[model samples]
Target: MRTSIVAVLYVGGWALFAWLGDSWWQLLVAVALAVVFTQLGFLAHDLGHRQVFRTRRPSDIAGLIIGNFGVGLGWGWWTTKHNRHHANPNHEDHDPDVSPAVIVWSEDQVARSSGLPRFISKYQAFWFFPLLTLEAWHLHIASFKALLQPTAKRRGLELTLLVTHFVLYFGLVFAVLPFGKALLFLAVHQGLFGIYLGCSFAPNHKGMPILTKEDELDFLRKQVLTSRNVHGGLLTDVALGQLNYQIEHHLFPNMPAPNLRRAQPIVERYCQEIGVDYLQTGLVTSYGQALRHLHEVGAALREPTREPTR
Candidate 1:
């Protein structure tokens, strides 16, 4: 079957579940939809990076429209930051999305984010949105910084695209469902989207050791050490968009999910040949690893020895 057909089937099936799931059985289906939306989030993220389709314009337009509700955040803004992420996965100065230091003091930053905003930036980094759209907020800030480059001015376009995306997208979701239902769904969907974003972005270099000032950036080494593969089950791959095989996706971002299954072996072989670590596990295992890493991360920052001297 064509990948497009498979995609439509998966998406269409979820729509059915979401619309008609009035019985107790719906909860089970809701769990399935949660997984599907996460995979969809990955595909949309892939599409945003032009790793899925050959032509980028249509994908960009679709990303602006279809992906807005889920991992939408800001399309134009995300593209810019995503490129930087791929380039410098863990560089503290370069990568704005994830910083190990965690203590930020920017004169330019608006009066030290506090209250809800501070909570979101610090603790909510993994789950700013149930639907992962607020990821655009992170992406937008990163993109705007990238836009500051004399060559590329993208901040304006990013905002315009996102605003247009909001009107059309929320318009449709609420148009079909009740206002209360829409907000509720938005809360739920965005929350789950946040879950999807958590698994999608965090596994790649988030909890891993930070790069040194002289750390060399090699392709396979970076993919192996910095990336991880989750879940081996077939069903998990379908719904999770091969996010379980994150190392493979990072190595070949253009490979589709189906091909990603095959690509894993090839990547594993190369990693083995080079004696690099290939972290592969079941879905729950990977999730636990990330959670544990986050805990370790929090503790590491809080250590009395590690704390900055007054």
Candidate 2:
């Protein structure tokens, strides 16, 4: 039923785009498509975690379809990277999520930056939300790059589906709309889609504990401490793709997305009983915490240099 709903909305959005001629409403269609695409992306995430199917093969097949073809991201690449993140949620060394790029999550990573990156790191917290507008395109590019590498797993199938996706996606847009409208459609769709994706995932671990190579903890503790739950009712659940239950989802990666809500109370009680710091906050609050953390890490760069005494 969930999959059916997602398919309908996604296809309907595309159909609406095809149906609309030269009009300002195409931009609204772009927003609608961005939303539906993000939902499909969450479904793809579930498939990658094998939470949607009983066996690995079926899930992988579904992931390839929903993730690669529907969403234009490589399922194999995503799964490999995501699994490593689960194994070490916020560990600087192992978790690709925290590996420094545009924004530094820790002071150590901020210190390591030099040249252009160093300059950027100083203002990264301010730029984080804005930069997220490009994240979907970034992931798409990363997916193709990873799949094209010789060492990538399931390279052939992933590449094929991804290529097919771009062909159909661009083909439909360009065929139906004028060049300028096509450009606007692509820009709005990809930009809003990326922001939606980043907003959903960043709050999960951004402000939580940062683990290092030498740090070790039990699985439960590690997952709980490094994850934050966003508080809202059903709307939040649907918007964030059940990821509002981040602590529960991280603790039980293979649990079905629908089941995460039910598991939240149990997980929260368990954390309380065990004396773990289970963080839960409103969406705005969580974003603030994440940005504040980013700002704090970048503080050294933002500091003014003192004048030398004569």
Q: Point to the candidate with the largest lDDT.
A: 2
* Full-model lDDT for every candidate: 0.57, 0.88
Give the per-residue lDDT of model 1 (tens digit) for 1-310.
Answer: 4346546755775577557633444444444555555565566677775765689787876665544444345555566667776666655556655542232222112124445543433343244224255443444355445545556544555455555655755775566566766665555555555556665665555555455457786876765676667765877765566666777777776676677778888878887887888887766666566556544443423454653221
Q: Relative to the unseen true structure, what is the C-alpha lDDT of residue 86 in candidate 2, on a scale of 0 to 100?
A: 93
TM accuracy, model 1: 0.68
- Alpha carbon deviation, residue 82, candidate 1 (Å): 1.5
Model 1 spans with C-alpha error above 4 angstroms = 1-39, 68-71, 100-161, 168-182, 300-310
Candidate 2 residue-wise lDDT, 1-310, digit = tens: 8899989998888878778867779999999989999999999899888888899889888888989999899878888899999999999999999988777788888767767667777878889988988999999999999998999988888899999999999998888889998999999999999999999999899988899877889999989999999998989989999998999988889999899889988989988998989899999999999999888887887776722111
Error of 2 at 111 (Å): 0.8
Predict model 1's lDDT versus the native.
0.57
